[model samples]
Target: MTTFDKYPTVIVSENEKDVWEGSKHIVKQLKTVALDHNLIAIECYPGIDVKKLYHDVIQPLNADETIYAADLFYNNHTITEMIESNLTEDDVFGTFSPHSLEEFLDDKKVKAVKEKLKSNQKKNIIIYGMGASLFSNESLLIYVDIARWEIQQRLQRGMPNWRTNNQDEQISRKMKRSYFFEWPLADRLKKALLNQVDFWIDGNDIENLKLISKEKYLQGLSQVVSQPFRLVPFFAPGVWGGEWMREKFDLDKDEVNFAWSFNGVPAENSIHLQYGDCKIEIPANNVVFYYPTELLGNKVYGRFGREFPIRFNFLDTIKGQNLSLQVHPTTEYAHEEFGAHYTQDESYYILHAEEDAIVYLGLKENIENEEMIKELEEAEVGNKDFDDEKFINRMRIKKHDHYSIPGGTIHSQGKNSVVLEISSTPNIYTFKLWDWGRVDLDGKPRPIHLHHGLESIQWTRDENWVKEHLSSPNQLIAEGEGWYEEKTGLHELEFIETRRHWFSTIVYHETHDSVNVLNLVEGEEAIVESINGEFEPFVVHYAETFIIPEHIKEYSIRPHGPSEGKTIATIKAFVRV
Candidate 1:
């Protein structure tokens, strides 16, 4: 009737190297398994990649096994209850060796006969684990094959068309996702477990986890921690799947992240731990949307990719495709004209391109009121009838072609070209001023929003914008040691910047004061660093969000194994003034 009763507990050491070796022995001993070993209750270790562990050790041994990363479920509840409900004060204890779960189900263990078993027989041992699903190569091959096809199918037929079938192959997927794998809902993970959805370790060195921290304490905290981060939510048309996002986490708009309950259970998060504690709450809009919304329209994947909150989408048009010449009202204009607005300022930081890739920035360069009105009428009709005309002036674009679209600038990605549009969250409030007859897959022409488009259009076209948008981005002494540094003198000190951030096996140092919003335009690194001494690595992707807070500079980021001789491109945006 105490914290340690009812089960034969095996507390492994909190060391990776020790755990890896201990694992070889546990797999061999578990063969004499009984019913209470039924739960095979497992623990996750820090920096341990569970998937790889099973691949090398468990599958070949052919034993039932389970694995969990303390990080992902650090905010999960069912996992906590699953662990706590099984614990009591009278349970017998053992290390990573020959232990018996028989004590829990009321069975007694026979005394040892003082004979030692061979540890290095090299026999094929049976391995069992919760993470077994991802460990076996056979299972991964099947999952990956199906996933690739799924992406292909959605791309070719379009998601909308796929949704109209009662006999859709994804119906089983729906049944499955209905219970587990849900975002914005705690029960999602619960359902996943109920559905027997097995997850494995997703990194290297995971082979050494069970031997590390036997700290069942963090597992206890995993249930109560506030897993806060911003997101935007939505669903793709024709598909029942929805996406969620929390992009604009205004200091004014949010209080608590969109709260969720899991597996028919209430959140175990203490009311006091809501938003104030953990000195490192990533920028969340007081909402717990599982991911970002699907707004990146026109063949581009939308927002839900980043684990971090803020991400920048860069679009560069190569050919002369009239960029559905749409305009966006400024934050102020958005409210007055459309009745709703958020922090939506987008810029076109253009690079090299052909001359004909005329990016129709705003209205034509230098024209009259009559001309503006006349162009609008013609542009609208063209979009209706699919006519390509010279309604907007063409910028003779060349190499290093650039433009800054601060909200109201009407721009589009032309065909056969390239561009980098550094913009705010892709919340589509684009007032389409013009598009020359674009049709959907249904053979129907897309509707053009003349009224909204015109309201947000930047009427005046200054001929010298190319000069204004272009800046010689340079580097200054970056604030922190080991931090990437490059200073520049462009727009009144802090306008726009393209920075180079690298994983310095050579220069990877530490910093504290300044925060860098890195847009990984170049390479990738597992940015595992500590905010207040807690360590976890959120991946830095090609097109994803990753933030290093101002205070948590005492952290280290090492490349994920193959990260030896690689370089990456990053566009850093922050207030220098």
Candidate 2:
């Protein structure tokens, strides 16, 4: 029998009510099984005496927990020796201080961690009980990209003995530097403790995140808002722009702006061509002046791009029209052909859809690959027939049904479909497959680029194509575990998956790991607690997402809101294995 199947680790708890009850229980259940190797944690009140229970046998688990553990994996003996003396001794620091997670600038202690959680305004949770686990003693941990850089700097100065695990296992050197170079600087308090010497984290990165459009920002205001409007109780006109102009954009701009108004354009307003809802006005030019050019560069395209925890396209269906059946290029696809930094792999979580609304997935079964090829190749002329649509197969899809679209997959939305299109932040690259043979008053076939679409198509097809998975059948609210792993879609070029939990959960990790993009799927009332306070117990609304860095572990979350509140969804996107 395998170690886990044989010697299951055991979890013990003293303060049963310590909010992380689910995680606490799982830890206990692990002990009964036979496991040769694994990390384990156990806590019971301030001093319950685990020695008496496990004293009969030598605990073989890799992890152990107590009231006074200073690195159980590296320093368990210290905790054991102290426990023999007294329960009220130095052990308290090991069991209660939040410092065990990270050294806080305020105070690297458990009580401080608790205080931060209690006062956290983001709407996280309170950790009343202590929980610990020694799991994953054997894990390959690699810090990559910016997060990796920060860890490197800290390790270089703070601890001298630290060294690389395997110098040769390098992450792809070409992720095309992300705006992580623009992450907000750590608070003044944290800066003091980290003491990153001469750590010039630049001053202008903030500009990239500044909200730069008001007219374009209000693209969908007509729906959630009323006409002949007053921006008071009806709709509190949200300032559409970033708050950290220089820090977000790293543009070094003093301020950012995105305010514009439009009536009509004189066809020749500017040099660049204008499309639906986009143009430079004239006569009544009435520039909704987004003042700063740094802000203007992005505003020119309106708020179609964003950064941070994530960047996505927010579609407001004030005017609904079937976007040409199209496919997006994956990050890899972008890099291979056009070269893109942001990812194009995407999925649609229906925010709001008409009852009878429909969405087209891919070709239905029985359509031969050669037929698909022939259809695309011989499609200059058209008539009204299913065969005439030479694009995505139109089908009715409604609320709550998630549509997973990997790159190179032919798909599109039909009439009356408004969705939160969550995907990579590249904000560029969409290959148009086909558009209904309709044109604007100009009578032009909108626009077609089959060359680009062909490059984006995933040739491989499974018998069961267009699989729309239903989310939360029983609302299997995770009691407490590392994470719920779900593999959703597969692509010849890429694959997609999601790791989510309602209540905050503890996910143990080893040194080598992967950074996951986390998008909040539901329940605006939830908080994700972490070792350091970067992820405070805060509230998140629908369509929101976050990133979980690799290596950090033991963070837990609790649902807010009056109901049995918890994080609704933390969808993850990763390269397929």
Candidate 3:
């Protein structure tokens, strides 16, 4: 059995009341670990109000609480000023700062924390805040983790009224007030302390945990380096969200509708590690930081460093509105203009398509630049419908059709379709040229980037050209007793390759120093096994995404049920050499 299947991981409800009850359950686990230690410290990000949580755990035990704020140890003015000066639109991913958690952990503060443990006055202490564990022992370290989406949701739900004045200021203050800009620095600090973290607790919905001995924690990290793993998918609502994901995934019905399901966007997604009755939630990016070569392979690691280089997400526009017509910057333009390392060269792999489902791609033939610009500008401000058919090429799609979208290609996923957006990791650089004259759910005009989109658009990729080249074709590569493999898209700038496999019997494959991401597109379930015993075999469900690290060189796939004489289809993507 796999680690998760063998272990009895704690399951908690997302209900507000049950979540707190779950926290109390976590306190019970912590009590056991705290018995041997003189001091217990919890490390977490800023803006976490653990006052009641601390009281719940420590008050029950009658242990005296010693609180130390990481902010208090910071050069407040210097850091604040640094963020304000460097913060820009380009800081969408993150901004680097000379002021890091290491520097903030002043020698005096570290010494003070160390001296307190040495004394006999208070036998038990709780040091809680960002980077607190950096000053303590590994066994004594308890990490309380929170999701970035949760932080933003909480801020919007219950912020002081005065904090929401100016639009730009409100956005900036949210990052500044919560110290989100310090994430890159915080990640650096966490990288150094990951090996030392003994207990990891989730502070998002309910208090879930992965409490393991130091040896087990380290062993788990090593196993992660050579496994076919999957991260917990992240869900979010958008203006044009639909009900497909909500009903399909059995997600909470109270939240509006589901717009996106982040299946493997390491930059913003997280993974959960199960150890018996406990589980630890960590950022997927941390997986890369710890095992760069193993996870990304040699060539990918050399080119992108610790960045996971690729992203896979679901776009649910079924029964919803169309996405804004957008274009991504060229690689050179992205680096020169935004300090971004890569550009978004994406594709739309149609997962489900309803009758008349359309995808807006490229531009119509003989389209006049001046007229198109004038029409888009008018649509941006006034209540007028630009003749989309005269400019944009709307193509009807069916299930499993792949449309390649290199950089500078204008595109949008139309309504009544569920699209799997496979692309490079640079996700936020889309320049929206048009929005179909529709306002956002907030009743505000969505932001437009006419100037940027105009500059990024490739006029050469017109309707006819897109039909001939961008519409991907499948080519049979190999066949076995009960299986066949078809190579799909391979674009130069896209830097990723895709293929489809039809199999009933086992099909053996190897990563060959390149990481692979796969999903069962047309099957109930399948089993993925490592032939060389590099990692445990795992079951993948329909439309569920999973990763195979480069270290797991030899693997095989076999359908779960007896052969019904029907071939199951799977889609696989990997970084191109």
Tens-place lDDT per residue, model 3, 1-577, is: 1111211111322222212125556667677768887677778754344554466554565567575655446465555555554454532323335456665455776777677667843467767777667657633787666665566566666532111222344443455444335556666777777777776556664434323344554555566776788867777888878778877777777988789988877667766655543455556776788888989899899989888987888999888888898899888777766567788998988989999899988999998988998898888777577778889988999999999999898899998999988888877678888888877766767778777788888988899989887887887989989999987775666888888899988888767568888877887778889897766677776778888888777799888753335678888888887
lDDT string for model 2 (484-523, tens) is: 5443332333333444443344432221133244444455
lDDT of 3: 0.71
Ranking by TM-score: 3, 1, 2
The deviation in Å at residue 52 for candidate 2 is: 76
lDDT by candidate, in order shown: 0.34, 0.33, 0.71
RMSD of each: 19.4, 26.1, 5.4
**Positional deviation of 42 in candidate 2, in angstroms?**
58
TM-score of every model versus the real structure: 0.42, 0.40, 0.84
lDDT, residue 450, candidate 1: 68
- Considering lDDT, where higher is better, how would the candidates rank from best to worst? 3, 1, 2
Q: For model 1, how does the per-residue alpha-carbon lDDT over 419-503 read when each residue is reduced to its tens digit?
A: 4454444244566655565553345554566665666665654445534552334445563433465543223322333444454
Cα TM-score of candidate 2: 0.40
Evaluated with TM-score, which candidate comes out highest? 3
